[model samples]
Target: MSSTSSTVLRAEHIWLDGKLMKWDEGNVHVMTHALHYGLGVFEGIRAYKTHDGRLAVFRLREHIRRLLDSAHIIMLQIPYSEDELVEATVDLLRKQKQQFANGAYLRPVAFMGDGAMGLGAVNPTRVGITAWDWGAYLGDKGIKEGIRAKVSSFTRNHVNVNMVRGKITGQYVNSILAKREAVLAGYDEAILLDISGFVAEASGENIFLVNKKGVIKTPPLSSPVLDGITRDTVLKLLRDAGHTTIEEVTVTRDALYIANEVFFTGTAAEITPVREVDNRQIGDGKPGPISKYVQDTYFRVVRGQEARYADWLTYV
Candidate 1:
């Protein structure tokens, strides 16, 4: 990932509703239902500049589908179809080609517009897509040298209280608080546990651990964890790379402390290795060999260096 700060780099235009508009012109009213009630769904996607000098989005369709699925789960109807949203994303990226020459992070959000203010109000659903230049989410140093994390006092949302399947905007409050708690406590990130006290995930990423015998384990989706796209990709990559002892099961805090390696996987964090948890050193306090391999392969596949996963990329 780029070493630059992860600030949003302004672009020429943004896709709003059904058309491209000036970035600054794309605005939402303060009275928007989603703004007040948190009735919105969104997705995070990345476009990469390939080794051959082509620009492509990683798993574009999958991300879009997930966005739509999230909306459906929240009962927020998006006005556009899947194909329409996909084209709009490609169009927005094409228009911002010069500004995001290095690649960009794409955010597609669907929310309720200004209308009835009641909690059960049925409002017009509005959609927007924005692309901007962003760098390593956990910082470049943390990615390379590994990071310190704390098991958050905050528990992951219960599946009954919050729709775990949906990436709803309001649902992130839990993550924000946990992340803030960790950062304020002098840690690099936060790891949330399920209500049952099993390891769930990081603030915004999925968690994985490698045991002493080379067995890899992660909390099952049955836990209050998001079905992360990067988590799936890493699992496939690791298996193909001959690390076949992967399992999806409940994990404890002690399990992470005693693991040979621990790492985070997500669209933003990518494959960030966890070197310490609760101040306990992890595997020599460095990015482990397996974590490095996964990170290296993930970057290669995203940058179009690997041809086997070519189908996963959508050229812009």
Candidate 2:
């Protein structure tokens, strides 16, 4: 749970209102509306070092679009345009990667820095950008053994009441709680369903299911899943490989038990396999072939190896 050290960490980087500070140095009002009432949005973007010692980020354009979309859902006006945000990320990573000479992680947030107690004040919009080393969020299982998850007793919130399309701060209270419950229950993570019991996502990651017939399936938008950048990458890779992709509403507490392969995808989770759900072993309880392929293709694409997906990265 400790953070990366300053010896390998870059303290100053670009952010608006425009000043660079240590990653842990900052002051936001404790009564900030986003903290009290969940009125802000954010994105997690990662920069990976290629085998060539150069660094790149996956899907720079798409992540910025989703960040802006999430901010719009809450009416938070970002001070920067999508292109500006991309440039900021590239710049910050370039600075950190130069000193650290390795991959770094970025957290770019758009939030209401100020809001009235009655929730009726003009939101003061701000962006806080930070970058440092991110060793791993899910560790080696991210591609090796894969992760094992549980069906959370908790369910994802309805989009009608809470915006599920973007990374909203308050919505993560739900994710944090569910993931905590699963960890205590002896699993690596939690998989939540839509209010209707349709498979939605695993805490912060998007879930994918593989059927016995070698078919790839995932819970589509009807299930209120986030349009994850990594999830889309795997989907596109599967399609380009001539595999049929089923992005429809799917629900089966039983399906997790039978899924020939199951995995989760996100900037944090990357491509993680799920070997079990609620103690039921998935496909002999191991990372399966489909999840492995997705991991291999995604890894190459992200690290600047595959030219076909070059448009997805922003080299720093």
Return the top candidate by TM-score.
1
- Candidate 1 lDDT, tens digit per residue, 284-314? 8999999999999999999999999999999
TM for candidate 1 is: 0.97
Global fold similarity of model 2 (TM-score): 0.92
> Stretches of candidate 1 above 4 Å error?
1-6
- Model 2 misplaced stretches (Cα beyond 4 Å): 1-14, 245-247
Error of 2 at 245 (Å): 5.0
Score each candidate by Cα lDDT.
0.91, 0.78
Worst 10 residues of 2 by lDDT: 1-10
Q: How accurate is candidate 1 locally (lDDT)?
A: 0.91
